[model samples]
Target chain A: MTSLTPMVAELVDYYDDGEAARHFQFRLLDQQQWPPPEPGQFFMLSVPGAGEIPLTFTQLPDQNQHWWALVRRMGSVTSALFRLEPGAILGARGPFGRGWPRPGSDQTPVLLIAGGCGLAPLVSQAERLLEMNLGPVALIYGARSPEARVLGRERDRWQHKLALFEVIEQSPGQTARRTPLDALPDVLAHWGHEPGATFMCGPEAMMTALSQRLIERGIPPSSIWLSLERRMHCATGTCGHCYLSHRYVCQSGPTFGWPELELLMQQPVTTQTPPLLSC
Target chain B: MIHYRLAELAELTRHLGRTRQVWQRSGAKEWCQADASNPPPLEAGRSVQSAKGFFFAEQEHIFEFDGRYFRETLPKPAPFALIGVSSCDLVAIAYQDQFFASDPHYQARRQQALLVGLECTVPCEHGFCPTVDAGPAARPGTSDLVLHPVGNGWLLTVTSEQGRKSLQGLNLTTAPEAMKQQRQAQLADCERQFPDDQHIRDGVQALNAGTVNASTWQQMGVQCLSCSGCTSLCPTCSCYGVQDQSADQTITRRRFWDSCLYDGFQREASQHNPSDDAGARVYRFWYHKFSDDFRKDFGRYGCVGCGRCEATCPGVIGIHSVMKRISQHD
Candidate 1:
């Protein structure tokens, strides 16, 4: 079942994907294809000396046993992870939490929104939808600037397959493109399809704003899903660090329907103005 | 279940210790390993800390990683008996039992320990067990054995098979069925003696109804120092964080008790914290204690009404204080 002890995943290779971020490919040394992770499922990565951090699977380990994660050099664990060599041994435990719900039988266009490195969680989903040849699937991604963008190679490939819109906050150095929100209307317009389901992950504000905008554009709150990031010590729900109301974000989510997440975020109300998704 | 009337409480303690390590009150608010030699009095007040540490150690090694493989470090505790655990503490143990049912490390220690519950003849200073249904007497199925102070002796009730077999050789006399009624009467009187807890009722209702103003929670958060005393003392609070340290090229991971009140408990490595607001933490703490959402999952509220948080909180945001504020706001 759930083991606190992580299985060793040797670093097969890695490459810089974005500013301070790397696309790490590791081979599951001990585990085989016993557990196949769905899109948006996360794993706990243990850096021998620096401790553990939760990362989403950009590429899940299949029969070949190659697992990929786009990890940003944020704190101690990632710092130690960045210091490792090609053959360095590390620890990984998971394929945990409720992953993104699969596309249903309904043939409604699926829209995905991601900000900065948040695109990692939705990569496989986009690929899955493309392979399935479902109604038009599109991804609207935003970054602070071109340099801050991640998964450059994936974006390049996705552009040919799906309706991909990349936006930047930087104005002068590059021709300014519409923000993710501004690009949303056009994406819907081009396809003449209102997304049956919208999946998003990013800064809290953007996700919240996007959910509200989706709702305004006549999408049900239940149809919008978001992946959350919280400090997770145990992906198994024993550690209450990832608690959101009665639910532990690590177990009940990492991905939650907008309505479900809104309920959790509203409890233990902290502000009279509005509930800040960051808190 | 079998019942026996015994003139000496020491005889039961001596019998239990013969087979397992005995832990009883060592000081007014402390419990430690002790034999039947110096048995501490079963006082009315609960210890400042609960017996949670017996099963869930405050700090323990989880796993060790050498350059190659990860090995789990499960605890192998000696068989032990916790003597004279209060009703509320027993309730809290049951709550933890359900929460850690799947955790191998917690189960490893918990399976080796026997719980002997003590019935409170009178209410403790900060207890509101009746309010939370945790009790003035041990709730059935929460303990292996139960002890009730009868008129000149003790009424020993065997609640579990473990309690029945542990005393195989001891000679005892069966109690009349009336003793059960007598015990109930004693508990009812004890419950009646508890102070008016309308505030607790009101506060819990307000919380579940989502009527308490956000600013009220914010004010309570302002007073909290994030000292973590309340959580440490709370019998059912079970949050943990893991740490890794290196020695001789091997990395050892130790899991230690963590507090949700700490700002960084939910702070991600990206510095994106969903609970960065102190008010959110304060509310989450009480919401866990009093929220109906948790009640549906745990079958009861997380707080067992031990009131350990009330005694340990330096800030006035203890159960009594927080409840008063919430109830008074309307």
Candidate 2:
């Protein structure tokens, strides 16, 4: 809606998430108005001399007028973002793509699954659900190790609002090295699989595997959603960098139903068959 | 339709040159934009470089950050006119018009320019515009002015009010009805000259039917050097990347054309790439052009059939070659 032009933002707060991840709070400098970002939507963050990269919103704009981004030190722009201080200024565009589906009613069951730093968007959703007084929410998170678990300081606050499960692959004090898939059955069993909406974000393989398991367990593909990440430049549909068949992940989605993901997963290259053109 | 004698057309070019830049295809492969003191003769085939960059610039500053605030750097180009654009290129521009309808940067330049289309009476060496519905003759609504060359003069059909207004001071006579018949005859004759493009039809059908297997793309990808020549010369390939450069206390964020053939185009920060294989990237590139899914959105295949990709690709994996390979191998 805002196109691809970025607005300058000043870093207002900074938080370290173990070794590989960091979170920054940026306040918009340009007074231009934009619709508030939905959870799972993202922004293109630009650091001087580094370039632009798409980062999902970890937390939406709060009362202090700050938007949060969780950065994993992966490439030039993200690595540059990790080195910035609180007073630094950067450019941001978007709040692009469709976000996760909201609950239909207060009693709707919401299950959130996140792996590693994929927890960012889910955290935002969890916070919103809590504020809305949405019922029966649960979060199942998986990390490689105990130290790799992000948002460690906020777990106490989250536990009070909704059920939170942390599955670690390898840690000295942990009894099991279960992956998200291993932990999913028990989580679903606890919920009694009462036909509620499920959302997941993580590695593609993990999401694919988990979605299939859910489908096998009688969950409708449309009722399950996942957040997708792709190499994006212009968040608008014009740039072809983020295309998945006919869909531009930046515009048509960053979030999509499991049925759509299944369609995307089935075709490795081309788009689905199109209707014939009446010349 | 108006008729302009071959000698009198130059007068119109000279008149328009007084207030705005007049761009016309010059030499064998270039568009010369300046005062039309001596306008070049209209060419028969497509120009080597399509008129894409005039609307969607090759590189543009999207915004600038001066320490504390960001400012948009929308282009403010002077009004200009493109004369003698080929039918294939005109169709491509219209296709882009729909894609960038909401993009302010593209609209900024597009609103300041006028499009003049030239119908092809003869097929170029490698073009198959007819197969893609892009044409040997300009389609209605794609261009402001349509030019059809006759024996001693040109039949200029003013399709838009802007085109009619641009000819205000020039003295032109109404074209004879016989000129329209002659133009249609010429276009039909040119259409029949196009080589057997059954392979393209077959290839597109295979692509839609999901009959072209992965191994064929792998074989084709081996020949691809990833030089980006095809994408660069393509009339409809519109992918780009953005970057920020620091200068003193200010930073400039710019967007430049990017190609899907590159592996890094779809790679994530986690080092996980959906299209990690070279063959897969090659397949995705072609799929974007021939896929039916995009047709539903853009109302046509992305390829305009100008065949410039064939002329520019060093790897010989251009549209014709790839389509031929797919048809043959399958």
Instruction: Give the top-scoring candidate (DockQ).
Output: 1
lDDT of 2 by residue, B28-122 (tens): 46888745777777766878899999998899998877776677898999989988889999999999999899888999999998888888888
Over A1-279, each residue of candidate 1 has an lDDT whose tens digit, in order, gives 367888888898999977999999988786544378889999888888899889998988878788889998989889889999899988888889999999885835888899888899998888788888877787888888778899999888887787887777675666655467666777678767788888998877778888998899889888899998888899999999888888988899999999988887786555333433221
Error of model 1, residue B208, in angstroms: 1.1
Tens digits of lDDT, candidate 2, A1-279: 245767777788888886587888888775754578888888888786688788888778765458877787888778888888888887777778999887677436788888888788787887877888767788888888877778776677887877888888777877755788888888777756454788888876788788889889887778899998888878888878787877889887889998887776665444222311100
Q: What are the per-residue Cα lDDT tens digits for candidate 1 across B113-232?
A: 888888888888778999998888889889998888888777889999988988789999898888877888998899899999999999988888888887888888899999999999
Instruction: Give the range of the ten consecutive residues with the poorest summed lDDT in model 1 chain A.
Output: A270-279
> Each candidate's lDDT (Cα)?
0.85, 0.81
Q: Estimate TM-scores for all models.
A: 0.96, 0.94
Q: How does chain A of every candidate compare to the true chain A by TM-score?
A: 0.92, 0.89
Error of 1 at B64 (Å): 1.3
List the candidate 2 regions with Cα displacement exceeding 4 Å.
A1-3, A173-177, A190-195, A268-279, B1-8
| Clashing residue pairs in candidate 2 (N, C-alpha, C atoms within 3 angstroms) | none
Q: Which ten residues in a row have the lowest lDDT in candidate 2 chain A?
A: A270-279
Error of 1 at A66 (Å): 1.4
C-alpha displacement of B320 in model 1, angstroms? 0.7
